[model samples]
Target: MSTTRRLRPGVPVASAPPPGARPVQPGLDELGTPLQDVTFVVVDLETTGGRAGEDAITEIGAVKVRGGEVLGEFQTLVDPGGPVPPYIQVLTGITTSMLVGAPTIAEVLPSFLEFARDSVLVAHNAPFDVGFLRAAAARLERPWPGFQVVDTVRLARRVVPRDEAPNHKLGTLAALFGAQVTPNHRALSDARATVDVLHALLGRLAPWGITHLEDLASATDPVPGDVRRRRTLADGLPDAPGVYLFRGPGDEVLYVGVSTTSLRRRVRSYFTSAEKRGRMTEMVRIAERVDPVVCATPLEARVRELRLIAEHAPRYNRRSRAPERMPWVRLTDEPFPRLSVVRDVRAGTAHIGPFASRAVAQQAVDALHATFPVRQCTGRLPVVPAPGASACVLAEVGRCGAPCVGGQDAAAYRPVADAVRSAMSGDPQDVVRTHAARIRTLVVQERFEEAAGVRDRLTAYVRGAARAQRHATAARCRELVAARRTDDGGWELVLVRHGRLAGTAVVDRATDPRPAVASLRAGGEHVPAPVAPATAAHPEETDLLLAWLEQPGVRLVELDGEWSSPVRSAQAVRDAAAAVAVALVAPPAPLVDDTPPASAPERRHTA
Candidate 1:
């Protein structure tokens, strides 16, 4: 799709400065196309229902206008491929019979798009009409052109007074603006009315210095003067995927962000009301410059953003502020290993979690304890207990094997410790099965509160274990190379080392990927082997990589070590967790007796 920018008919062109003279800097007025020069396609649509994706468009009408002159008009009836509701038919006066011989949306979309091409889209409620058009394009597997949209409803709300118009509806705005064509719920008439409303709103805004197309956004949203002045900070940024940092007075990073699309557009958005976060507004106010770090692929940009956030710990960046704070459930090194929630991972310690919180880690520990006869006490147990050491209540209650008091020798408890280690490592079936059976027993006994607590603990343990195992599987691999086909038929190649996103590159379609793959492997960051059961990278970063790898059509190009999970164990736990969740939500079945009372008759009564 092509977009054309045309100047107003009578506007004069500026001449270049003489060879010796200094070049003049352009002002904000010269930043974008003037309103009079912009071609706008006033559009309207009649759909089967209010929803965009689910409902189908029945009619499309658009008027392409420039310099207050109607250049061309397009109108078509579309076969929605479904029955229209009676209310819709009545409101639109377009019944199913009227659409019997009409072309389908797939047939009508191309012509409509061509007609509206190179023009800003103007609509009464822009999202409603544009959303349907976008949905149609997506359904047909066509790319929707990036079009500037102007919602006349929003403009009217800002320009018109409540005393002059009761509401900003299309009909009300049309009458208020004295439009020649009145909207009657039909597509073409509504579109024609919207054109007049748009022109009238623009005229009202013209006196307020909204003569340029770029000014319309600010006019509708009313951005602060200070923030708007800083838009120039993005003037030199490139239109590419990258990480951007907002630096403050002392050149200290205040905020960090990443953009897969044009970095300039993304940074410019912070000056508009589109960025509504109070903290971000404050950050932008104090921000002096925007620094861009361009990357070859979006994945690389994202990874760089994460690293920058971690390094700077920017105040405005709430996420990735303290990845080190993620808690892990580790089996400590001892004669009788116990689950301990620690912030760091040590070599040779069996671990299962980088859970969201310490509380969640504790819950998982409780679940493990309920299943395995591991010691729950915080104190460390010896290889041999004191001569007269007594067993704790946990041992008396049979909850623990009390190796602390020598009730069970290390030789006898070795199997139990090994089982716990196995569960934390990969095989969690024993733990899952034990927890599932106990939860079922509790539910049957009508101990619902107790069952819910057990269910939570079970869910926490299973989810954390599954996540940790997946991360560990990836982190243990010495090196891996993967590729996925991009939307444009190009290839997105990634190199991973010890689960860290080491490098990424994009290979254009029809180009040989071997060179890029070779370069990525050669230049990728070096990541040493991580401690056992802990990922080399932050858990969050590893999680992102795993999700990307699991996307459909991702192909593993190379692997140095096996990347696998205990499928049966994880799946069994997931199934049991899902069943318990359903059982908890549903009301319990009442106990029914088949035998009737001796004094009661088994006769049916007539109403």
Candidate 2:
């Protein structure tokens, strides 16, 4: 496709510098240009060697552009006096026999340099190629051109990333982009790919307010592409605990996550980390940049995350509508009183067992007895153990009826396990439905709060019903066992294929609220919840947290089938992430303040 029409009106592109003129800094003139109009040239070179300082150039090709419009093109082949190395000749299909009487760098250098005048230099592996040109300039006693250069390799990693591929070699990129590498290894062929890659890169950078040539040319080393540009912003982040934002280009918000230590490192890892493979690649694609807001402590990061989430309402953030009204689990203080789902697990009268993974906590009631059994372990049966007249382990101690051991009927233990499951799931509706028939027995003789708790639990279930609507409807929600977190958590879902999602389930639930939500909502197979608080300093915990947090950089999150099982859950995440990435690719909508008119100040929270 012609990129000129898609130039975003006047967006700057990485174009080759004019020939026979010294390279100059790009973008400065764009700033000086009318409303940021400037020329750009996507440049490419093919040579007989590797080292820019020592290699001999075989071909040079470039595309000159102004304000997103192609003005002209330049290409030429130079002869190297010495015979080309065997490997070099094989790789590039160039031969000393073909270059019998070609012009030397001394002759072609002037035209190429002059043509590049007042424009930016661009190459697939820009540094390697630009390095050679710079060295050549120095060898000729001319100062190396001060022209700005754009690295399409860097741009490809940011614009269109893939975890399977390490460095974005021209061939690797061409295969994925499907852009024909007709004249592979030839400067003109590679130059065409450079131009195409530049166009894709420009589209990716549009969201970052990176339009003018000078803006792209003057960028620091690596010419921060879409996702990698986050590195620069990450530098300002402190290692201490803090919240971070993954911003799309043009200052659009992508994702909001928090960390306890090494905020900058964590953020940097998301862009460069390797473990982030399998989902999250889409964010890397749209993420032309990132901007971080640091905090001195983790507590601060939590508060900050909540506040930012409230403000940004990042499409990728958790989808709870009313966090303050979300349900919580309530376990009575009595030795083994029934556990109830409530609105405040932290507020009052509730011994808040830390929120755990959906699977761990759901199946945890039994696991807990396995760890510490007691007179407090049973629901209907009394806590005393009986003699060996066929008693189970818990029954051996009078704790359980030992249905599995044949002490009691399966029917007898069913209700008990069901209650445990209900409690773990925080399903107040189940509690009410199961025990409502007993209401008449405790009728006027009861503590109202206990009964009221049941009513409130039912209400929470009802309220959450509407919220149970699926986000990834296209994700096979019917067969999917999704996590129903109350509130406060984030998930990393990778979308690998153009229309499909792939990869592992990276559920990061911490002592923090958002993570708590993520833990509950991630329901595929069973990944055991963290044993202690996520604050525990274990290497596995740290590594897992880091893997989920930044995704080890964008390229790594391709949602590939590297991690298997939990297919439904993985699809759920990938579907959600793809939905968000799609939104990011388009323009962002204006933020409308949801607050009510000042005359009705109290209604602000009603939404």
Candidate 3:
């Protein structure tokens, strides 16, 4: 006999196990449902032959049940519209004469479908019965109402041992489970026996937390030997939104992920064949343990997953594992500040990006430089310039104030620095429009290649500016609480601080959520005003929170500061920027001569 005790509903299993024993874990389905709330329709079919296309159904029997109580029963004989083969008569004891007065498949199907509505279909061998019904529907020129079918045979294989049950065949399972009715090769008797088998299998799965209809339907897939042995690694895992890691030999991290709903289900899914990625499959094969960290909200989980990936640099993680390498556009805090692409963001500096790459950040910088006379020199000059100081070509062409050569004093260069900072700070449309006008002038001159380069630079600037606006909006908030009604009759509450997710909770509509929100606020982490690297750890967190804030049905409950975005939608900004480029590149009108015409022009309309 197995030494493991049955898992109680709502109680967590032990995290550690005794030596030489496997740990018992709950099922991946976290949504608890009382078995009484589930409806099942046990069905059995007797047909002319095994092949659905070549044969016809002779009889159909079904029992609708809830919590072992029979709600209703359906039994009928179907006429094949042809003679029943002699062999079918011998096997089922159903003859051609017996079905002579039976209703045709078309006549009986509608009523049978109605009886099974809103119930999970159950059969000993589901495919055999379901296949014939589909065939019958095709012949009747009617659409089949696809039903969620459960096979008792497959369930038996999972729940009962082969040695104990002999085999998963109907008669063997019925006898093994001591079913209320014996399988006698008749539709009603076979269906009644399968119903008892289903109940027995469900009881066996109760410890695994398989109580819901969805879990029941999907539980039949056999767990591979290697994965089954490590099932204990999931013991005591909470069914909440969180991050999980798969560790291999020597405790090396193999993979990282976040689950918005149930972490258990998401982690367990990796070991199943449904994961088609070959690298992931190999990772699972070598996995030694599963470590999970639960978060109050999915947003927090996402942020944590990214941080963990950056920390570990696991081989299997494909994205966001190198947060340190993402490029940023930083304005150096020097006398005659110039835009520079840097890997690190410092405090008290105006910065524009955590662009996807350094090249993209440079493109934005280049575009802004083309329109504004910002310094392009890399030198750090003092108030008193040294004699014979060299000047870059940008200063010679009037593209810069020549601060390096002391041609322009710091007082005169302040406006240029302020313009660059303002253009980068809020509403970059001014810069875009100016550059767009330049591009239009070039286009009017038929400078196609030059126009293309300017267009690309404009595109990059708009995208980076939109992202920076969102980041700034999130960074400005000290605390925010919002709620939305979920489809499952519950309210989802999310708390955000600065930009990161602080907490989340789902509560029924009848319950007051004020206390939870208050507690979250009292215990939530406070983020200081937006600075450089501190705000750059998880850029995606800002994106996710922004998306959630914009979703329909979301209502703001509390706020420490006003949440607003100065930047418009990326597409709108891009269009406006492009329009500006068109105007700039247009040809200038010819200058008119100062000399007036000898005779005054005549007016067509007389007063």
Candidate 4:
């Protein structure tokens, strides 16, 4: 069977660039579109070499079709204006002499573009053909109308398992699908076979609920038959904000997720090709049904999601579920208090960080210990020195106050504990200055290695202090209204309280933002007040809000409480100390004698 239709013989099958060229929006219809309503132009190219920049197109072929009917055909040969590599000449059956009088790429691209207009571009490996065409158009200074691209290769990979197809190569697919035309490495012949393969791929989409053009381009996985059978399970889900669970055999939960948009819509999407993640695909395959736990608002949904994940520890859930596992920089509540890295933030203990890693938390603790003579020994400390207790090397080196030995009692050590708590909560100016001064002293003594160590400790201290200050400021805020411009022309309003996002809303340019902002603030006030000892509140939620606030370009729209970092904080002290240290270690300026040589100036006179 042959699908090739020879266009008017010897006609110029390519067009030159139009006089005025402008970019065109990618022509794609809405998602969930019926395949019959979408037009696709299957394209193939024969080039001199693989690279678009280095190679030249020898021929272009395309078949424009809709609903299994060929709308038109385009074919052309071009003089590549360069020698075709010997291997390519034998491989493609197109020789230099055969293209002696053929038009150049500049003449071919415009016509090809015209033929494939208003259709999704389809190719076996879409990138190769599309890339070559785009490169050719760019080289000829022609504007490329960004066309929607669909790869039949990707479609075959999703539709047919690797065991069934052997491989996704165009020829293999053409034969497997029993195409009317065979791909012979010739542009037109290959394109026609690709069209057949495309139709076959489309036929596979209906069962997976891929009826739209938008869905086709983004589709990378086919919904497994078992997963599709459970699609109706999402039917009863309310279109509201909530957490949804995908449960597998034996009622075992496979995944848990929170949706700010329609819970039903988001849950339903998993059954289609929209969700491309490999793990998600596997989870869906085993999922017997979806269970939705609806919430009043998106923020509530998010909070509930975190709670559920922490409770269930679902296999497919990765983050925001293990808040208790995060490390905190805790100041032990003892008479001789010492800074330590603890995973669990307990009551009556002052803490700074819920750092991303324990290493960072330890670094912060080390920074504090370096600046203050705090005890570094672990375990319970006896009020008085025990007869057998031996001092650690740190205490021997004056890094600790030797509180374990009763060298410094609780009353005497209270000031040091107070300074540490103040530094950790607010400014660490004295601590940063102490590290900085030590760094300079070490540099002056030419103890370069020790100086670097001091500098690193100082840097860590300043960073920890800064992060703590930010978190404290956020935690102290009664309410905060912040806005960040979204990708779409709209503003995303974030309502934060005690460092947790209380509520969120989006205001479009078409709406009166002030009213929405006011309404959001009013609703945000009703969120459950944070628990006492702020650390007891969800640190994950607090961390999430902190991350958002820390992102560049987020604007503070309004704040019910003061939101500020210490201007004369440890960070400032570190900068000053760094400058002094750099100057102290700098090479001495070349010496200049203050006393001039005792030489008289001589005058010459002409007679």
Ranking of all candidate structures by their lDDT, best first: 1, 3, 4, 2
lDDT of 4 by residue, 152-216 (tens): 87777677775586678988988887888989778999999988888778777656656667667
User: How many residue pairs clash in model 3?
Assistant: 9
Candidate 4 segments whose C-alpha is farther than 4 A from its true place: 1-244, 250-252, 258-282, 290-308, 343-349, 356-360, 379-390, 410-415, 428-466, 483-491, 507-518, 525-537, 547-558, 568-607
Tens digit of per-residue lDDT, candidate 1, span 456-536 = 888888888877777777777889899999899999999988889988888899999989999999999999998755777
Overall lDDT per candidate, in order of appearance: 0.80, 0.48, 0.74, 0.72
Candidate 2 lDDT, 1-607, residue by residue in tens: 1233233332444455678889666564444332135566677777766887787778778777665556677777778667765334435656566787878878888887788798777787788888878877788787766887778776665555455555477777666555534436778777776666566566667666565554564322332255555456566677676777888877878788788787777777766544233235456667655666766434345545765776677866653323434333344433234444344433223222222222323232322233222223334433332444344455666666564334555455555645543433333223233324322233233333343333333333322221121111211111211222222454433321211121223344553434433443353233322221111112222223233333333233222122222211212222222222222233332122334376643211110
Error of 2 at 279 (Å): 8.3
Which is the better candidate, 1 or 4, if ranked by lDDT? 1
Error of 2 at 276 (Å): 13
**Regions more than 4 Å wrong, model 2:** 1-36, 163-167, 175-183, 217-607
**What global local distance difference test value does model 2 have?**
0.48
Number of clashes recorded per candidate: 0, 53, 9, 4
Error of 1 at 416 (Å): 1.8
Worst 10 residues of 2 by lDDT: 469-478
Residues 1-607 of candidate 3 have per-residue lDDT tens digits of: 1111222122112234668997567566555445657777889999998999989999999988776667878899999888766435535767677899899998999989989998889898889999988888888888888787888877776767644855689998878778778997789889888878888888787688676665765577745678656667666778998999989899999989889899988877776655544456567778888899998667668878887888898888778777668788877898778899888767777777778888989999998888789887766788788889888888778788787778889889888888777767654656666665666666555565566667678777777766775676667667789998877777788888777777777788788888878877887666666563235337776778778888999988898875664322332464434344235434332122224354532211111
